[model samples]
Target: MTPDSLSRRQLLTLTGSAAAAAALASLSLTGCSDRYKLRCQHQRTGEVYRELNIEIGSVITHSWIHSIELSRWTDIYRFDGETLMLTSTEFEAYGAGMPLDEGDVSVQDGQVVIENIDREFEAIRWIHSHRVDYRIGVDGDESLIDTDALPDLEPLELRPK
Candidate 1:
């Protein structure tokens, strides 16, 4: 055909290149193409984990009834695709193993609320208890862990997936 007209192979290549460029532009505009899922797993074995959809500002909370205090304790985390930020915490009562030196403390619904902690952690680990309630929550949706069924004192963690 004419010198200005693209051959079949050249046309196909151009179409593929344009499609790839559009896909990349879409990802750049949406601004979270590399988002990670919040994952919970058995720490030692690196198994038996669950992954939950997480956005840049997604909130993850882990709460449990403290065995010694027999009261509720909750930790609030924010996921940023690469790390988890400990944003706040709530303790029902002061007792063993509780933070007493933290700043920005207040009382919300009778629980001691500590905000603006703003600490980053690669993974958060905890022990599974047979005698207390344990749960993992994301954006108000919660899943209760069968802590009693897990091996006594089995370790578990939440990290970027």
Candidate 2:
């Protein structure tokens, strides 16, 4: 073949390879973005939880107060792969004019067991609380749970300073 024709063919081949590489890189990035949008939901209560931007072996605490004198709740979560373990603590400052408090509000060290994980990133969690058995449903999605809309509960540290 002529030298000019050979050069033209080589250029076309290189250009095609570069385009493929770019498309692959974009797909890889898009996959990561999708993972970041994962969420967890409680089937019974319809309570949805936004996955905190936490790394493995890391713990994050989210607290809210509902008239500190009346009630308050704190949730601590640890994430590992498709599994997320959560420790939820709720406190009632006053009960029927009597001091009645329950549940461990302190940070506990350990891993919570995951019951199930589905193709849609929906996870079923089994929690033993106050001697009662409970199942929590967790699902992933693009939209995150809006804590701002919750009534009577104000996030302790998420507010602007």
Candidate 3:
């Protein structure tokens, strides 16, 4: 084949290779069980907290997590797996902010716990504070998920935050 013809064939092969690589990249992400979103509520106070969206690929399933946030209310001093993060604005108002004096956030036995409990300012703090963890899954059951679920979403009416 002529030089120009050879170059055209090489270009086509490279294009196909690139397309295959891209497809494989996306497929690998889908195959991994590490990424998903969760909706949870606090068993106590019947308060709700929606964690909007969380990409857990980088977060360990059962590990201590240190977070920094700016807020006047709902100072989330600590959290365990049991402690749920609000998924939306509505639920956030209901779940309430974690107490500040409680101490550092920590994960224990696959659960998250906040030390202090300042019921008096929870509500007000939730609205003002930028950090909070007090929502629970409606069924209180955890599910391995590939897609985000909104139990509080319309139609299903899973839970009223």
Candidate 4:
């Protein structure tokens, strides 16, 4: 092959290698968990939750609601899987501990049915102002919830540290 052709091939190979290395490095640093940026605001009090990364786990409420785990930079909370069924703004508001009435944030034919967005926005603001850290699992219990009590939500395959 000509020197020009060989040089071009080498450059292409080097570029490809660099890109692959960068991608791998980023993946290793970030991990496979789902990342979220949830902002909660309650009135003047507002908190921005950044870089929330959570692994797959079951979050069960009293009525067997399956909530997906969420995190702030420091604290963690869980939202019902149905919550994702809403819009991004709605999700953020809910993450902030705003009230979600059936008509405001529920799904109808797979679409977000939010009418009074202002109310939700206010609620989010209120939550952030309150300085409430989102929490996961049973109230006042660090132990894994009994599998029998939660027929829908399963126990953590791995024990909590």
Top TM-score model: 1
TM-score for all models, in order of appearance = 0.73, 0.29, 0.20, 0.22
Reference-based lDDT, residue 6, model 1: 47
Which run of 10 residues does model 2 get worst, by summed lDDT? 152-161
Every model: Cα RMSD to truth? 9.4, 14.9, 17.0, 15.1
lDDT per residue (tens digit) for residues 1-161 in model 2: 42222333464475576764665466557653343323334444645444434334343334444433433434444444445345443344433443224333332333222222212212333221322212222233213335433322221121100
- Candidate 4: the clashing residue pairs are 41-124, 41-125, 42-125, 42-126, 42-127, 43-125, 43-126, 45-129
Kindly report which residue stretches of model 2 are placed more than 4 angstroms away from their true locations once superposed.
1-28, 40-42, 45-60, 66-73, 87-144, 148-161
Candidate 3 lDDT, 30-70, residue by residue in tens: 65322233333433344344532333221212111123322
Which regions in candidate 3 have their CA more than 4 angstroms from the true location?
1-28, 31-35, 40-53, 57-71, 77-101, 104-161
* lDDT tens per residue, model 4, 45-139: 22222213323242212212213433222112233321211122223223444445534456544333344332111111111111223322332
lDDT of 1 by residue, 52-150 (tens): 667778788888887677788899998876789999999888766767776588888898999988889998888877667787788778754344555
Q: After superposition, how far is residue 10 of candidate 3 from its true place, in Å?
A: 42
RMSD of 3: 17.0
Per-candidate Cα lDDT values, in order, are 0.74, 0.36, 0.30, 0.30
- Model 1's alpha-carbon lDDT is 0.74
Candidate 3 residue 70 Cα shift, in angstroms, is: 15
Mind sharing the TM-score for model 3? 0.20
